[model samples]
Target: MQFSSIVGQGEIKQRLINTVKENRVSHAQLFLGPEGSGSLALAIAYAQYVSCEDKSDHDSCGVCASCRKYQKLVHPDLHFSYPFFAKHKDDTALSFIEQWRDAIIKHPYLSLDIWRGYLDAENKQANINIAECHQIIKKLSFKPFESAYKILILWLPEYLDKTGNALLKIIEEPQPNTLFLLVAQNQDQILNTILSRTQLVKIPCLNDNEVKQYLINEHHQTEHAAAEIAFLSDGNLTEALAMLNNDESSYHDYFLKWLRMCFSNKGLEIVDFVDVLAKLGRENQKNFMRYGISYIRECCMLLAGAGNLVHLPAKELDTAQKMISVMSLPMAAAISELLEKAHYHVERNANPKILFLDVSLQIVKILKFKTIPQGTHYIPN
Candidate 1:
């Protein structure tokens, strides 16, 4: 992947290119960033620039032999190591190379949940097993087949367990011309020993404007739709992309209607509403819950006299202001917690009908009866 192909992160791309230009390329570097921030794509682009036979001043030439191979992720000198569900004792990332290539090529902003869909995951735990650790050592032992450097990009080193220690010697004193690039999200989950050895390249999340423009220019989103998704996504490109696939435009109306039903204590209507929610499917259900949570939080902000911090658009802001007149801060908090719990359950494949009914009842208790549920305390006005 070329740096131009990745969205945003202009400073990061230049910095990575500078490392190569100045001949200060670190053999082992960690590209640490939140998910959907294009950290993995940045790492791949950096590696391609390093391996490019006809490198330009700012980026790699897309037509060179090395560039062609790297674009397809079939370069002999370019290797990848990532967390996988190993079915056998000797299974390594190489076993799922084709799946890995397809998934990454399809969406470089891939999350673990998306990757799980690519494999026969079936509730299996994903990790870099001892076999993969040994495989890394063996792979790095070889010399570069074509490029100037042999690059191994290990995604999510946080999945590496204690067995990752087997590569300590190599990391500390790697063979000449061998580079280890580790792409990870959470720093706290990684091994301290490995963390200490690698050079840290921090990548920040994309800004709201960047995500908004990308949706408009690349995805052909309407200006208003792009703005709404960008605000709701909060710098998460993966979430924005997912929202594009689903019908999130009606969330505001649906959420407002649900609140109206709960507030009026309309039992029969709520049951029908629950039936409709149950049919949204898992992703839509989760997105709907998320929309409700965000909307409720905005109401809470208004109730707490923090209207300046709210990010809702004008129409939603008008609705939020009107809603806050009838809702108390504590009630909004309670309902927000309920929506959060519903979102969690939806992610775990809960029965949507039961989950929505339960959540609706909880909202009724808070809004109509002004009673907070057990285990969730809200400060009284």
Candidate 2:
């Protein structure tokens, strides 16, 4: 991946470029950032820049043999390590590197969930096991194949178990020209020894303005739609990309239809709701659930005299206004809590039809639930 193609984080991009230019590239580097911050993208660009025969101030020359190989993730000297779930004939990560490369090339904004989905895993977890760590040790043992540096990009070191220590010595003191780049979404989960060995680089998440601009330019979206998506995404490019890929504005449409049904006490509309929800892909279903939970919290805040904090769309003002009135303060708070609980349950592979039905019934009840008198207290200790 070219550094120029990455959206936002101009300053960090320049920092990476300068590190290579001055030959100050650390033997071991840890890139810690939240998802959608381009941690993987930055690492790839840095690897390409370091291997580029002719590099520039802004980015690498994309025409070089090394550059072309890096773009396709086929560079012999540039290796990747990420969490992978076992599948047929792909019981180990070393066996699945080709698929991993293809998936990332297909969508660099991917997350662990997306990776698991690509593997068609039912509910298995993704991890970088100790065996994969050994593979890294074996691969980097040789000299750099034509490139100036042998770059090993380990994405999500947190997935490594107790067995990962086999490669600790290698990572601590690799071959003369090898570079180890570890990318993590959660820095706290990294081993202390690993943390101390690598130079830490923090990547900040994208702001709304940055996200909006990138969406407009990359997706050719209208101004108003882009602004609304940016606000709703809350600085997560993965979430924003998933939202745009749906083409149906599934959450927005469901949010509007669901809220209207709730406020108008239209329980008869449950069948249509179920039908529409059943059609969504797993990612979009989860996205809608997350959005609903957040939106409900916003509604509660609005009822509690925090309307200014709500990030409602310009077009959603009318619906928001109506929802605030129809949903009593106590009901709003209760519904928010219920949705939050439901969200957690959904994330754990709960049956969606049953969960949605139960959640829907609770919402129907909350729509008519009466509030207690002010200053009321429940005794339970």
Candidate 3:
């Protein structure tokens, strides 16, 4: 992946380039960022630049021999390690290398769930096994065959588990001209031994404007649609892309209708609405809950007298204004908390009908009865 092809992160791109220019590249470095922040893509681009036979100051030359191999992820010296559902104890990342290349080349902003779809991963968890760790040790033991440096880009090192400790010796004292690039989302989940040994490169999430532009330019979304999805995605490009297949405005309408039903404490209406929600499928249900959480956060902003800070479209902003008429800051916060918990449960395979019904009742208690928990001060108008 070339740096130019990746979205946003201009400052990060320049900093990575500077490392190569100044000959100060760390042997083991961490590209740490949330999913869809282009962390993995950045690491690959950096590697390409490092190995590019004819690299310019900003990026690798696309036509160069090294660049050609890196683009296809087929380089002799470049290796990839990622979390995989090993079919057999001996199954290594190479066993599934073809799928990995296709999946990543198609979507660099890959999430674990998306990656899971590429495998026969029924109910199995993803991890880098001890076998894979041993393979990493053996691979890095070799010198570069074609490029100036031998590079190993390990994605989601958080999945390394206790087995990751085996690779620490190589990580600390690697062969000459060898580079270890670890890309990950959660720092706390990584083995501390590996975490402390690498230099950290922090990658911040993309702003809404960047996401909006990408949708418009790349995905051919209309300006209005892009704006709405960008706002709803909240800096997750992976989600924004997935949402391209789903209608987000419908989510806004349904969310508002559900809130109004809860406000009225209409039992029959809520149960019927829950039925609709349960049929949205797991991914859609999660996205719907996420949409509600983001929308309520905007309502909270309005309740706190931060209307100017709200990023909702005109219609949703109007709806939020009307909704906040009965919503105190505490009430909106309480509802947001409920939605957050609901989202968590949904991700963990909770029954959607039961989950949605429970959340609706909680919302009724907060909105209709104004029964926020104690210690949360609710001011009366």
Candidate 4:
């Protein structure tokens, strides 16, 4: 993909281009960034720009022979290695190349969960096995086939096991004109040996405006809808894109209703609400609680006389202002803590009905009886 096609990261794009312009391109580098930050896309665009026959100072000429091949991800010089469900000991990333190409081409802000959907990955663990590492070494052993550099873009090197050390020789002393671009999210998970051998390229998450504008211009979402999704996503383009088909716009209303029921301690209504929550599926339940957490934070900010820092849209801001009238900063903070714990449990496969019911009871104790949680002696501001 071209740099023009990737969203945000204007500074990073320019920096990559300047690296090529000044001929300071490193042979081995790590594109380190949070998920949905366009690190993988940047790596591919940089490789294409480096190998482009008719390249300009800004980017690769899309019409050149090398550029054409790179656009389709079929270039002989461009190889890719990524985490995959290995069905056999001999299976490697090349074994799933077709699926990988399709997944990346369609969703450049790819995540492990999304990648799992593209395969028949029932109960299979995704990893970069020893076979793949060996393949990577063998692929780079040859000279460039069509372009000046033979590039290997390895995605999620964090999945590489202790066997990753087998590739250290090639990584440290590679064939000339070979580029090893490793795209990863978690630096702590990568083997120390591999981590120390590469130059670091840090990529920051896209700002809210970048995500909001992309939804408006690309997805044709209403300004308000884009703003809401952008707020909920919190700089994650992958999450923003995933929310496109979801009924995320209703989260605010549903969350408010649940909170109101909990505050009233209406037993039957809460039971029904918990039932609905239990059936919304695990991902939706987590998202709903996340929305509650963020909304409560805004309420706390308003109660603390920091409404200026609130980013809620107009309707939500009005609701928050009204809601904070009855709830003190301490109450809002306690509810937020409950929601945070609920979100954590939801991620760990806690039974949704029991989890939500227990959280609702705790919230009731906080909102109705003004009872501080046993361990947390929150002082009202």
For this target, which candidate reaches the highest lDDT against the unseen true structure? 3
TM-scores for every predicted model = 0.88, 0.86, 0.92, 0.88
Where is model 1 more than 4 Å wrong at Cα?
A: 120-122, 261-282, 305-315, 337-361, 372-381
At residue 236, give the lDDT of candidate 4: 86
- Candidate 2: 10-residue stretch with minimal lDDT: 372-381
Q: Which residue pairs collide in model 3, if any?
A: none
The TM-score-based order of candidates, best leading, equals 3, 1, 4, 2
Model 3: per-residue lDDT, tens digit, 1-381? 789999999999999999999999999999999988999999999999999989898889988999999999999999999999887899899999999999999989998877887886723679999999999999999989998899999999999888899999999999999999999999999999999999999999999999999999999999988988888888999999999998778989999899989999999999999999998877788789899999999999988889888888888889999998988988888888888989888776687889999889888888888888555453332
Model 3 ranges off by over 4 Å? 120-123, 351-354, 374-381
Candidate 1 per-residue lDDT over residues 1-381, each given as its tens digit: 999999999999999999999999999999999988999999999999999999999899999999999999999999999999988899999999999999999998988777877896734678999999889899999999999999999999999999999889999998899999999999999999999999999999999899999999999999888988898887889888988987764898999999999999999999999999998766678789889988998898888889898888888899999998887887888889889999988877688899999999878877787787667653333
State in Å the error of residue 336, model 3: 0.6
Task: Please report the candidate that would top TM-score against the real structure.
Answer: 3
Collision count for each candidate, in order: 0, 0, 0, 0
On a 0 to 1 TM-score scale, where does candidate 2 land against the true structure?
Answer: 0.86
Residue 274 CA displacement from its true place in model 3, Å: 3.4
Candidate 2 colliding pairs: none
Instruction: Tell me how far the alpha carbon of residue 112 in candidate 1 is from the true structure, in angstroms, after superposition.
Output: 1.4
Error of 2 at 60 (Å): 0.7
lDDT for 46 in candidate 1 is 95
